[model samples]
Target: MEHSPVRKLLTEAGQRQVEARIKAAEAGTSGEIVVMVVEESSRYRHASVVGALFSSMIVAVAVGHFQGGDGMWHFLGVFVPLFIVFHELLVRFAPLRRLFARKGDMADAVGKASLAAFYAKGINGTEAATGVLIYISLFEHMVRVVADKGINEKVDPDAWPELVGGIVQGIRSGEAAAALSEAIDRCGELLSRHFPIREGDRNELSNQIRY
Candidate 1:
């Protein structure tokens, strides 16, 4: 089957890691599943960060207008450039890269679980768990996106911290999928209840991620 160039690239990247993990699994190496999930999650999370940062900046600007603060513009002028510079440094510097690497590991774990669910047979439990995780990570990213649009007041501040804690616990307990799914469901519920987006619009925004 023919695939889009972007899809082809993603498949190639995923295949490399999947192949390595399969080999490790066959060799009786434990943690192969976890490793695969982590790798994918990291890639997704990094992309999400870029999205979140830009979104946050836009929101900050809008909020500045309401508050009538020239300070906001000044902060934006200084920090936006600094942020861009820091992001470039992160791409180039090993230490900075490693430091922020784990920030998105939660997203990666759930993403891998979702993939595993699609490919692995008779392992519905893993698949289900991963599916939940993927949804949750997406939801978290959604919240960040919404926040960037100046909708922070719509979100409960406690939600993010709780979700992060759950992700960490899930990783520690080797139940990453379950933890991720729970977080996603909670976030989704909150979003639906407090900040409902039209299905068509939400899907439109989500589809952009594929590219």
Candidate 2:
């Protein structure tokens, strides 16, 4: 779990707080809330590599042109190794690497990844379909709430955007765990109202923070 993208930014105490919130949130509801945080949904290396090479080519051309033939050779000589290093560095660096991807593309990536997680984590398999997934993809800076059909049909569709907004703000403020817990609480209230825990209601999914 520690090696998972979800664990990259959270502290041990923060992780525990998130777990506690999940437990508390489920107390009155049969709905299952699963939190999945990730460093990135995709490597997006293709975009990053293209961006790096394009920028390097421009720089090399511009610098070489200004310096004359000798300068061009020198610039190319220097840039080859520098570009290699830059490419590697850019691939790992979020702010720079992200430039390679469009905002819409990132959003799309996040949506696809979240949907995959919804099924992979067994949120789709919950009894009564009362499962909700809070998915955070760090590189794209996106947060999505995925609810199963039961909750979706019972709750208002407009209700979640505001709730998700709160969590997004919290995460932007570097309050990863707090933001997740808050979102869980908000979702829990909705679930409790619509799907109050019945006798013999069981936890269909594990409460541990997923990466």
Candidate 3:
């Protein structure tokens, strides 16, 4: 239930557009490109505890000020209920929960999730080792570009940051689909340059966007 944050990040039309973009991107290159989106990279349950604790402390301080007492008992009482309430709130609301999560933790989680997605979706299964994964973690507002060994050998890893930044900017502007379309086109250019489609190249991956 915690994972089910309103799957409204992309509409049906947006998904189709992204899927089409993936197809077009792969057409010019032997590389297989896959786009995967997730509501979140991780549950980040610790964030809920941290949020609850912070909220409870604030409320307890106010309560103590009003009651004019040592406030240990008052603090405890307020903390117990507030912790429960805030914990649920943070878990259900990603924007609020994000405030409590460390940037390092979010980055690590997204990095690992993208790698998992690359393997899970069989993006690594291409014959020429030219598969590339464009992974998006919505809750963390992160984008990771994972390229297979074949492509990595020819293309510098540094080439991906600009592409990732474009997607991140798009996410911030609420135009993720369009941003991704442009990024995929750029990816196609890069891939085709390094790994142009061979006469016998076959489509090794599905063009559909993965959830």
Q: Which is the leading candidate under TM-score?
A: 3
What ranges in model 2 sit over 4 Å off? Answer: 70-85
RMSD of each: 17.5, 2.4, 2.5
Using TM-score as the measure, name the better of candidate 1 and candidate 2.
2
Question: Best candidate, lDDT-wise?
Answer: 3
Error of 3 at 12 (Å): 2.3
Q: Cα deviation in Å at residue 195, candidate 2?
A: 0.3
lDDT of 1 by residue, 1-211 (tens): 1343223223444434433433332232111112112223234347435644654476667766676768746658655765576666655654445544554564455545555533442222331121111222322221111122222455566666666677566656655445544554554555455444333331211111121
- Runs in model 3 with CA error above 4 Å? 1-7
In angstroms, give how far residue 31 of model 1 lies from its true place.
34
Give per-model TM-scores. Answer: 0.31, 0.89, 0.92
Q: Candidate 2 on 23-102: residue-level lDDT in tens?
A: 99999999999988888988888777787788888777777778674655687795787678779878878788888888
lDDT for model 3 comes to 0.87
Of 1 and 2, which scores higher on lDDT?
A: 2
